[model samples]
Target: MSRTVFCRKYQEELEGLERAPYPGPIGENIYETISKKAWQDWLSHQTMLINEKHLNMMDASSREYLKQEMQKFFAGEDYDKAEGYVPPVEKE
Candidate 1:
């Protein structure tokens, strides 16, 4: 059986990540508190933010902005969205 956690984002028990996404305390916190689904969602959103905002990952400010957004995202606070971007409709 897989591990389960009370995911911070979803606010309920769900499947947990097999390992921390990266080294350090924050990653360990995510492994303990964030669900796999939430992490995947963040990745997709992060990609959209990077592309739409033309963020340069090598820049410290850009990285810091993403880090702040990531915190807000998991905290269920108001987070920035890709301006004027629309989601594709799902097939029935």
Candidate 2:
């Protein structure tokens, strides 16, 4: 996908999140930090939406296509030496 389209789609989700309300400090912190449990909760909610609205909403194919594109993007670089390829766990 073109960067413009990708940004447009991503901007919408981010804007939605910006407008969403958090009920408590912990929930607000999770939304900002994306902690493991928060990630899992987000994953579960997304999964439910995917299963129930495969045809009703969301571009399901976009996920698979983006995955392949991202893989292709990183295939040429060495994991240990690649520029801007920091492993999350290894980051300090």
Candidate 3:
């Protein structure tokens, strides 16, 4: 059986990640509190932010910006969005 966590993002008990996403305390914390679904959602959003904002991961500032955004995102607070971006419509 899979582990379940009281997901901070969803505020409900849900299936948890199999392991920490990366090394360090933050990863551990996420493994304990963040649901897999929430993590995946963040990844998609992160990619959109990177592409729309033209962020270079090699740049320290860009990485820091994403870090801050990640915190806000999980906290359910106001986070940066890709400006002037529109979602593509799906065909029936």
Which regions of candidate 3 deviate over 4 angstroms?
none
C-alpha positional error of residue 81 in candidate 3 after TM-score superposition, expressed in Å: 0.5
Model 1 clash count equals 0
What TM-score goes with each of the models? 0.93, 0.27, 0.93
Q: Which of candidates 2 and 3 is the stronger one according to TM-score?
A: 3
lDDT of 2: 0.36
For residue 73, model 1's alpha carbon misses the true position, in angstroms, by 0.3
**Winner by lDDT:** 1
TM-score of 1: 0.93
Scored against the true structure, residue 8 in model 3 reaches a CA lDDT of 92
- In order, the Cα lDDT scores of the candidates are 0.94, 0.36, 0.93
Candidate 3 structure lDDT: 0.93
Tens digit of lDDT per residue, candidate 1, span 2-84? 99999999999999999999689989999999999999999999999999999999999999999999999998999999979
How many residue pairs clash per model?
Answer: 0, 0, 0
> Can you write out model 2's per-residue Cα lDDT over 1-92, one digit (the tens) per residue?
21111122122222123321346874454344333333444444445434544423356685554334333322332212223433346566
State candidate 2's TM-score: 0.27
Q: Score residue 77 of candidate 1 by CA lDDT.
A: 95
